[model samples]
Target: MRLKRNPTARYPETGEKRTVSDEKKRGGAFALAQRLGRSLMLPIATLPAAGLAMWHTARLSRRRTTGALMISVALTAFLTGITEPLEYAFAYEAFPLYAVHAILTGTSLALVNALGIKDGFAFSAGGIDYLINLGKSAELSGGYLAGPVLLAGIGLAYGVVYYLLFRFLIVLLGFKTPGRDEDESDLDTFEFAAAAAVAADRSKQKVVHSHRRA
Candidate 1:
């Protein structure tokens, strides 16, 4: 009896016909997943701090109309890490600003870590846990009061950086961000042409009726 071999088997690296030893190498999916997962750590590390900063800023900057409402909205984002709704509103419309946000978030994490202030929560790095830990136990809280100062600076820096960079990039690259590309004249021209055509048709119809009457 002879042993059978799989014709479809291919080398992982070269995509050539696979031999028995090819099984020693890892599959493409596994390799790609590992690489991509490692790359995600930087962004994931920043989310908690970013959520906290946004929540705190909204809470402190309340107005008569939107004060309480904005605070509640920011709190939800802080606790849940569900920023997609807010992010989607401006991410594509102002991509450079979004990129600055990501950079500032990473900076916030770095500043907190460097200050020897360590804090972690099982759920999320939201205000609830942050406040709870503040009074719970100094040993556990890791003296996170320093966090607010760092976050304040990060928020201010983020605003200035985002504004300046967004303006520069928009002018330099000519990106079609939300308000930059609309042409009201084009629509006005179309409307004018349509109205003129309608008037001409009506006049032609009136001439035909008068001639028939005559």
Candidate 2:
């Protein structure tokens, strides 16, 4: 589900109206101070999508640093259950990380199912969806806190494991995950531009030579 972005996502994160080079000002500082996890990391284990989103986006979006796309995407997956953007961050290069993600996601789903934790989503299986479905799940299971608490516990543990494991693999193995890898397309563009300039220069030189001969 595409998160309808606030005209200005604020600090309590950033208030570039929408995003920015100016992120570190205040909003950026807050999320950074906590490192986003210092709890946001909890969601990916349950949602098994993001927290890593913020981590990866932070790295890749250094150009934007605290830009809107980075901030919005990370939050969207946690709140709305949209993860394609986040997944794309490392999906192409880090197939191994993706495989790990699949295992963790499957485990989350299977465990929830086995425990009979009923939940549903209107847009996706995000926090809002979880909340909306909370009542239904609780009634069926005869407890309120049980579902949230258990889910939180599992999600946090999984989140930590993923964070540490992913960090290790990315750092140690040097997976060309997004920000870490230069886009071949960018290199191609540069090469093409250079060739075009060279051709143009040669064409001009030929015309000048012909004029001198005349």
Could you give candidate 2's per-residue lDDT for residues 28-53 as a string of tens digits? 42222212111222343432433353
Could you tell me which residue pairs clash in candidate 1? none
lDDT of 2: 0.49
TM-score of 2: 0.56
Which candidate number has the best TM-score?
Answer: 2
- Show model 2 residue runs off by greater than 4 Å: 1-70, 182-214
Compose the digit string of candidate 1's lDDT tens values, residues 141-177.
2333443333334545554554455556655766543
